[model samples]
Target: MELILALAIGVLFSSGIWLILRPRSFQVITGFMLLSYAVNLFIFITGKIHINKAPLTLDGVPVDPTRYADPLPQGLVLTAIVIGFATTALYLVVLLGSRGLTGTDHVDGKERDHDE
Candidate 1:
């Protein structure tokens, strides 16, 4: 499970980097979003994967809370997700304004000639 998670993060990070290098403004925004998601996953995994472990004890049962996964990372990831969404929305607005002003979606505010 941990290996799979690691590979997933790597894939997301790689894809994000690739997209970031693209010439399109929208692709860059999407790359940022994907990078943020990768970071969130990393943060969440720092708390460790608890299989079949209950975070809260039931009926006053004696279970070590420390045995359960830490909740701090979970909270952090949740907050990051919200912030990422807001930033993505803002980025889209900026992208639209840029496209409108430049009449192009390229990051440099202009489209290149097909020959180039």
Candidate 2:
């Protein structure tokens, strides 16, 4: 399980770096997504993984909380997921507006300037 998590982290990191290096704004968005996923995974792995563990208290039974996985990471990941979605949506809107107004998506605005 740990190996799988490690492999996933590596792949996500590589993908994020690759997308971030691209000149396109859309690729940069993808890179951000990948990086966020990698970060969430790393945070989760720090807490360690457990199997067949109960999430909460049971009737008349004292359970060892350490034997179960931490719920904090899951909540954090959910929050991150929502925030990432919002960020991606906002980025797309800005990219589209930029392209529509300037007639180019490039950051340097060379395509629009050439038209003048």
Candidate 3:
């Protein structure tokens, strides 16, 4: 499970970096989302995984460290997910607005022909 998480983190990081280098606003936005996902996954793995663990408390049950995972990371991930969604929506609006105003979507602005 640890190995799988590590591999997933690596893949996410690599893909995020690659997407970020693209010369497009949308790609950059996607890269940010991917990086956020990688961070969330990394944080989640830090708490360790347990089989058939219940997230809520149960009556007449002692606190079992081996059976229960930490809730802090899960809470953080939830917050991050909400924030990510808002940011993505904002970015999409900004992208559309910029394109509507400038008639281009290139990260560095519109390309010019040397002959012009």
Candidate 4:
């Protein structure tokens, strides 16, 4: 499971980087989203995967690291998701406004001449 997850994260990160290098504004936005997802997944994975375990222990109970899930990563991932969504929305609005004013979706504010 860990190997599979690592591979998935690598793929997402690579694809996101490739898209980020593109000249299209929409593709850049998508790349940022993908990168954010990879980061969230990494944060979640760091908390470790514990099956059938509680997030916290009672005050009287003995604390065992293996038996309890770490809640910090979960909370961080949740917060990151919310922030990523808001940032994505803001980027989309900016992209729309730029497109309307400049009449192009390219990051350079002009279309690339592919014939060269």
Please identify model 1 stretches exceeding 4 Å from their true place.
56-63, 113-115
The per-residue C-alpha lDDT of model 3 at residue 17 equals 95
Pick by lDDT: which candidate is best? Answer: 4
RMSD for each model, in Å, please? 2.0, 3.4, 2.5, 2.0
TM-score (C-alpha, index-matched) for candidate 3: 0.86
Give the CA lDDT, 0 to 100, for residue 59 in model 3: 87
Give the distance in Å from residue 63's predicted Cα in candidate 2 to where it truly belongs.
2.9
lDDT of each: 0.90, 0.80, 0.82, 0.91
lDDT (Cα, tens digit) per residue for candidate 2, span 83-109: 878988898888888778877767544
Clashes of each: 0, 0, 0, 0
Q: Quick one: how many clashes does candidate 2 have?
A: 0
TM-score of each: 0.87, 0.80, 0.86, 0.87
Minimum summed lDDT over a 10-residue window in model 2 is located at: 107-116
Tens-place lDDT per residue, model 1, 1-116, is 99999999999999999999999998999899989989999998998987876655577677777767677888899999999999899989999999999999999888887825
Query: Ranking by lDDT, best first?
Result: 4, 1, 3, 2
- Model 4 Cα lDDT, one tens digit per residue, 38-75: 99999989988667788878799988887889989989
lDDT of 2: 0.80
